[model samples]
Target chain A: MSLDKEKIKHVAKLARISVDEAKVDSLTKDLNSIFKFIEQLNELNTDKVEPLTSILNQSLRSRKDEISDGKIREKILKNSPKKNEEFFVVPKVVE
Target chain B: MSNITNQSLSEILKSIKSKKISSLELTQEYIKNIENAKKLNAFVTTTFDKALENAKKFDNKPNNEQLLSGIPLAVKDLFCTENVKTTAGSNILNNFVPSYESTVTKNLWNNGAFLLGKLNCDEFAMGSSNETSFFGNVINPIGDHLVPGGSSGGSSSALAADLTPATIGTDTGGSIRQPASFTGTVGLKPTYGLCSRWGIVAFASSLDQAGPMTKTVNDCSIMLEAMSGFDDKDSTSINKKKESYSKNLKDNIKGLKIGIPKEYRVDNMPKEIDELWEKGKKILKDLGAQLIDISLPHTKYALPTYYIVAPAEASSNLARYDGVRYGYRSQKGKDLIEMYENTRSEGFGDEVKRRILIGTYVLSSGYYDAYYLKAQKVRQLIKKDFDDSFTKVDAILTPSTPSSAFKIGEKTNDPVSMYLNDIFTVPVNLAGLPALSLPAGLDKQGYPLGLQLIGKALDEQKILNIGYAFEKNCGYKNEIKKWWS
Candidate 1:
């Protein structure tokens, strides 16, 4: 049930976050304690239950496959941290 | 102090419509109160200029078409407001001005409600106390040293302090109700899909619900009626017509079956909370309600299951916050992947980062089945418990929170202790049922204690009726003197 620094670091990586080296021990401790607490669910007998995704059991509603929203590119792109005329600027991915 | 702030939502609406009080005057009074109460740290953004302009427009020619016309209300920072900053109480979104409005807030605006400002909350609606907000902790209006329960802490505090007539809050797991309970105000988490979650900041999408935080149950009903309607934008929105809850507020629960879930009795619960439950039961019994002993056996697993399910959903939902898109971007990274990591690490607060990490761990390759899938299955069991119980009882009653408001920074170091504050309230969210917290009585310290009424799916009317009957006798008022300068 104990999470080590390596595991914590791995999770931070997967989550696209960077934890400070000094804080990893404390984060590991917190994660372990939380995992230990949630381990109580292991005691339940949930053999026949189906995973409840949505409470209202409503089927997904579909509409005509036409563009409904993407008309405001200027408004949408205004929030970008780094943007050109029509694209969000990120570091080059291709080598 | 202007008595206008003390009036109920219905009273204010009536006065506005009757021209007894101009919407501009009423709005100005709220603006003054909001301006004067900065010590509470309840508001993250104040739309005073916009509110005044909107009030003038409404006063020129009052519109009966909108229910909230000229009504000054605060929105929790989670809901998106076009051209206004919607931070969701996080530094990542500190400068993020949304282009579109949330459907619920849009519905309110369409019905005549004007915004006082955006209120503070726990970052991404994660924490039990408002301390996790990047804007700083929202102080409880009732007690200077106490915290306004969160992640809708600012909503509750604003209402309690009379800074605004009413406010809107979101509840993923007791975000709305717990804060309402702590502040001695009324907050209802309507049935999931009742209100559109279209533009509200996502935190556990399946569990997040937007509801009203108000001075009275009647106000909560009125506000909810205005805020809820099926939106084609939200995939899960129920296609049913909105119900007129305010018109249907009948104070008669006679012969109605009320269930007292035995599983809610936890060890070391505050004596006042237990007494409040007993008192609540007695009040319902006095109103001729049939109180029955019921059991939700999976109650103990609700918190753990919620921790897994909510964070799992949050982890997925919050993935949109990379450096490339909107919000904060870090300059420390030299490469793309490093940029994403650094941006997220710099943007999100500690509590938010912890949840993201926990979420990532649970949903990781080897642990997905053990954590996420298992939690989903247990979630079904938890829902089944409520489903079976509803067949026998019309509604369930329990203590809203285990105790009244605790002093600020009391449980900041221990996240688990903070999480326990929502023990009695989270099950309803996991099951996607309607629930409300109403002030039941005052504890010995004069702080208010609240009791929750959990209703079956889409059965908000029954819950409101029971709450209405109980409120008549509770005699609780959040008329605490302003301790904050």
Candidate 2:
């Protein structure tokens, strides 16, 4: 259950977070310590248990697809780091 | 008038209603306290002008219908205040102002409560101590160099130091109760879905719940009543009528069965905690409660399972914080992918990044079943253990935290040691039950010790009653000297 630097880097990539190479050594150590502690859960037998995603067992409620919220596009765009009159400004992806 | 901040919430409300003291005057007094208590760092943002304006407006209208009319209270920064900056104590959201109000804050305002300001908390409500806050660690009001237990450290510290008459904080894994324990205030984490999670900064969606941190158990009940209700916006919001928790706080535990979970006795538990537990049992027994020994067999696995599930969900939830939409964006990126990576790297704190990495690893391609799915199943078993125990007992009693508040930087270097602070409180969240921590007594070092009472789902009244009874007999008052000033 130990995590190495490569695994930690892959996880950081999957999570879209960049880890500095200098800190990755310490990060790997921290993650491995936590994993070592968490590995104790493997001893428990949970063969018949259902995965409980939420405490409330109710199913997701469905409704007609309509615009219930979000008419103020200005308000929605207000928090964006970079926004034009109507669109968010991001680095060119397709280019 | 000078000692107005020392009055209880009920007293403040009564004075406001009786016109003996105006809401404007009371709000001004609280503003002064917030200004004087700058050294504690309890408040992240103080809405003094807004609070005074609201106070003036309430003074003119004289609304008897509003329960909290003109009461100035601090809110944990985790909840989105419509125009105020709600950072959740993270640099990633340093300037994000939510367009909409969270249902919980809206409910408080509707009941005539005015904001003292947004309080500090753990970054995204992730850590146990306030050390993880991006602003700075909140110093404990009770002792010098002592850490106020968190992620609701600001909430508890403000309430304990009388910076605000009352405050609100969210608890995922003892975020509310543990700080309340450390500061000797009362914190209640209501049944999951009892309070809508509509506008809260998501931590672990399933585990996160909003509750009250107040000076007394009675105020906790009043605050919980005002802040909770079913909302259409949140799919998980319970649709039941809200209970009259404040009214049901009379001293009554006659014929009720209170379970003392045997599994809570971990090795090397502090002497004072054990003594406090015995004292709690004695008080309940003296008040005609039937004490029974119970077992939640999967208790030991709660913290490990919580780490797995919470971080997994957090990794997914935090993916929404890329560079494009909102929050802090790094300028050192050539492309969108690098933009996101660099932005997140610069924005989030160390603990947050660590959780994200752990979360990513557990949910990554090869390890999902062994970690994520297994934790979910283990979560269910944890829930079943509570369910089985509840069928036999009316409520469960345990120490809120394993020990009293620790000094800052004592356990910061080791994540596992810090995670141990939530040992008693995390299980209640995993089970989606209501639990409250009230100051029981002071330890040998004069730090406050807290005892927790856990109730069945949607059964907040019973635990409120239990907490009220314990609070009355415990004789613990969160009266600290004005050291911060």
Interface RMSD of 1: 0.9
lDDT of candidate 2 over B266-340, digit per residue (tens): 999998899999999999999999999999999999999999998998988998999788899999889999999
How high is the CA lDDT of each candidate model?
0.91, 0.91
TM-scores for chain B, listed for all candidates: 0.99, 0.99
lDDT of 1 by residue, A1-95 (tens): 67889888888889999889989877888888888889999997777878777787778998999976666888878999999999999998898
The Cα RMSD of model 1 versus the native structure comes to 1.0
What does the i-RMS of model 2 come to?
0.9
Q: Which stretches of candidate 2 lie over 4 Å from their true place?
A: none
**Off by more than 4 A, model 1:** none
Task: Give me the displacement of residue A62 in model 1, in angstroms.
Answer: 1.8
Single out the weakest 10-residue window by summed lDDT for candidate 2 chain B. B470-479
lDDT of 1 by residue, B134-193 (tens): 999999988889989999999999999988888899999999999999889999999999
Q: Which window of 10 residues has the lowest lDDT sum in candidate 1 chain B? A: B476-485
